[model samples]
Target: MVELLAGLSENCVRLLDVAAAGVLLSDGRGVLRLVAASSERTRLLELFQLQRDEGPCLDCFRTGTPVLVPELAATADRWPAFCAAADGVGFRSVHAVPMRLQTTVLGTLGLFGSQVGSLDRSDLDLGQALAHVASVAVVNERAAADSATVNAQLQHALTSRVVLEQAKGVIAHVGDLTVEDAFRVMRRYARDHGRRLGEVAGDVVERRLAGRDLLEHARSVDLLPEE
Candidate 1:
């Protein structure tokens, strides 16, 4: 994945109307991390964005849409830290394209340049195309790699699914809730308490976690439906 991201960022600089480029990809849970950059300054700038949790890539990631900044100076008010940082690093413009395929957003492809002009429509289109290609390639590579563990994971998941369902039924019965509400309640507890859903479900299925107790937890967290 790092190799792919590195290559993609390099290509964005070499082939597009940009002086530098950076790539930021999200983990499975949507936390963005710096993947690659075309230059040292660009790398540091990307890191700054990650640390501050602002800038074009972050905005694009949050909206799952492209963030095109034709002129950094013009947009200083919108992203003060980012503009100041870019100026410090000698970047005058930025264009952030969403690295997404369909509804799933993988990350963003951020193009930067020393000049302060926006890319033409054609250039922007090409940038979007490159980002899409990178997204597809990354997804395919991951799918291939995950194939090795797919069987084992599937077996465990199938067994866990049964236990999870049984636990849901138990919670529903004890809480006087529908199965759907029972599932939401269970998931909320696991997430809030820093436990895995499957582990908590296993406990409930094994009678380790009582359904009445689960219901009480939901009520405490205000996760229960209003009567």
Candidate 2:
């Protein structure tokens, strides 16, 4: 599986205008860890984005959808920290393709380009194929990792879901709103604050910040309503 992913990354670098390529695998609880990269630069960049909790990769992973940013400089308003950091690294554009099987999303494949341009249809199609391959690689890796405890898979999945639900409640309470409204508020906060919504939600649930304090902080940051 590792060799396959390495081959795919090499193919992506050769076939596309991307300077760097990477695959990220999500643990199903909003945590995406790097699985593979075409080069050291790609790995470093991905880790940087994950640590900062901002970037197209995280967006794609969260939405379970592709994200194509044609011009990093022009999209500064949309992703302030990500744009600045990517530009500093000489990346002018980024594209992220989600790796999904049916309704289950496994991860994301991200491409970084040093030039600015919209991805053509062919590029999009190729990216999707790569994402599919990445998904297969992730599943294989997971199977290998859990080979000793096959029966625990379902339990782990359930626990992850429970944690995610608790995190959602934390967001709702912190924002002083309904669940759906809280999600919207959290998403908006993520966009404006240059952080991932899941990370913020986790912090809320872990009691790192009080619910009322979160509400007040959100208001101060222009993230949510005062009430």
Compare the candidates by TM-score and give the number of the best one.
Answer: 1
Evaluate all candidate structures by whole-model CA lDDT and list the values in order: 0.79, 0.70
Candidate 1 lands at a TM-score of 0.62
Q: What's the TM-score of each model vs. the native?
A: 0.62, 0.60
* lDDT for predicted candidate 1 compared with the true structure: 0.79
On a 0 to 100 scale, what is the lDDT of residue 62 in model 2?
A: 91
User: What would the TM-score be for candidate 2 when compared with the true structure?
Assistant: 0.60
Residue 138 deviation, candidate 1, in Å? 1.0
**Pairs that clash in candidate 1:** none
In candidate 2, what are the lDDT values of residues 128-226, reduced to their tens digit? 987786655445545644533322432343343344447657767655576645544554555677875456656667877556655666678766655
- Location of the lowest summed lDDT over 10 successive residues in candidate 1: 149-158
